[model samples]
Target: MQAMTYHGPKRVRVENKPEPRIEHPNDVILRVTRAAICGSDIHLYEGLIPDTRVGHTFGHEFTGVVEELGPSVQTLKRGDRVVVPFNISCGTCYFCKRGLTANCENTNPNADLACGVYGYSHTTGGYDGGQAEYVRVPFADVGPMKIPDDMDDEDVLFLSDILPTAYQGAEMGEIVDGDTVVVYGAGPVGILTARCAWLMGAGRVIMVDHVDYRLAFARRYAQVETINYRQVDDIVLHIKKMTDGRGADVCIDAVGCDASGSHMHTVLGKILKLEGGAPTAIEWCINTARKGGKISLIGVYGPPWNMIPIGTAMNKGLTLRMNQCNVKRYMPHLLEHIRAGRIDAKGIISHRLSIEEIPYGYEIFTKKQDECIKCVIVPPRAA
Candidate 1:
């Protein structure tokens, strides 16, 4: 089997690796059909994620067909189409019972303090990922969502991660009817976040990014207003101007890390007076929220940074909610939405390449070249 392996910053290779097998009694093996690149995977490729080691798989957002199941896996059988949740969880854990599936205790026994995640790093559970021809899914009953036989691969693939992450962002913002929502970053996840906000009944969805292509994509798909942070003098003030000086009712910082993309600069602007380097987008989110408004941080954070304004957020009486998406919890509901055709999650996919092209795909996606939003690495069967 050929898998994309991450060695270091901007270093990736497609090499032959051993096929996966069910290691745990609760595990199942999937013959991967479609896998999509995620923003987090880019972090790994660019060496942004701290403690990420070499020789790990590079993707987590994927859907596949079950090839084999462990002895205890009775809910699903061979040939079942499934979408694997990015977050690994045991449905029977205490946290799972409380609807906090991301914090499942039993599945991440090696995690000293946090829940484990697939293909992230040792700090995130040290588990293998699904960026290859095959992947072993532990805790299969809890992590795999059976895809409807009638649905197309593109429509269901995103339900694994981006769709859930987008939903989590909207939920974090407390989006509601008649509310104005502003989302930073028009990348795939950001666009999906904006789309989810509109679907959740937001009156006006404003997206912030400098990419004309992404902003245009959002407008076409979800009717979101566009704000290019590059052109604006003061992002917060500009947003306030658009919102009649009240700021956005909900502000989502979809731009992760202190390092910015080609369109934006740092994660935090120089205007923020924090001690170390703070994320510029986080700073913008803090300043862009109306008094008592909700702010959602859906972007990935790497290592520790300084220079964030806690005082401003505290003074404004703002509500902040952020975390890794509890993918297991939302997969069922999102599946229904997919079945109903309410969300077109596949609109973000800009490239589709074969497993052999995995290395080149990573290069373009990590460089943000060719207007690459999301690249789907299709297995041989998909061709």
Candidate 2:
């Protein structure tokens, strides 16, 4: 089997690896058909996430056919086409019972914070991901969803992560009818966040990014107003002016640790390794939101202290909600939206490459070249 293996920061390659087998009674083996390189994967590729060992496979958004089923796996059988949620949950834990699968106590009992996440790192329970010809899936009954007979793999691949993540981000905003919402970042998650805000009854949606191509892509695909922060003198003031001097009713920070705006944050976080990640986007979200407005954070941040404007948040009476998405809980609802043509989940895919082109795929995506909004990896069998 050929798998994408991480060597170090900015180093990944397609290398021949041993095929996966059923390791646990609840485990199943998937012959991967379609997999996506998520925005979070870049954090691991760049060494921003801790304990991302060399030779680790880095992919979480994937769909496949079940090839082998463990003895206890009764929900699925061999030859079942499924989209596996990135969060590995036992479905009976306190958090899972409460629909918070991302914090399942049984999945990553060793970790105090987040639960087991596929292909994230050792901190998230060192599970190998699905950027390969074959991959192991644990706790199969709880996580894998059967792809609809009418849908293709491309149509539902993102339900594994970004689609649900974007929906969850919008849900956390509590957007009311006719509310004005601003989303920071024009990456895949940001683009989908803008679209989901409209579904949640936000009358106006604005997306922000410094990259010209990404902003343009968001405007066309997500059907929202876009702002190039690089051109604007003050992004927060500009957003306020657009909303008649009252800041946006809701603001979302989709750009997490790798945000680029302040020199000090960039120098200290990305260069000096003094902080977890740059808080530039979070700062903008806190400042641009109206007094008592809601702010949703879908961006990935490490376990380190960030210089946030907590005093400003307190004085303004802002509501801040953030979490790693509970993907399994939202999968069915979002799938219905896709089936009804309410959301075009596959519309974000800009490039589709074979497993052999994994390295080049990462290069173009990270560099923001070729107007790349999203990239999907097709295994040899699927191709």
Q: For each candidate, how many residue pairs have backbone atoms clashing (under 3 Å)? A: 9, 0
What is candidate 1's lDDT per residue for 126-198, written digit by digit as tens?
A: 7778788888888888778787768877888888888899999999888879999998888888888887888
State residue 101's C-alpha deviation in candidate 2, in Å: 0.2
TM-score of candidate 2 on Cα atoms, chains taken together:
0.98
Give candidate 2's error at residue 217 in angstroms.
1.4
Candidate with the greatest lDDT versus the true structure: 2
Regions of candidate 1 where Cα sits further than 4 Å from its true position = 109-113, 258-278, 381-383
Q: How many clashes show up in model 2? A: 0
Which RMSD values do the candidates have, in order?
3.2, 1.0
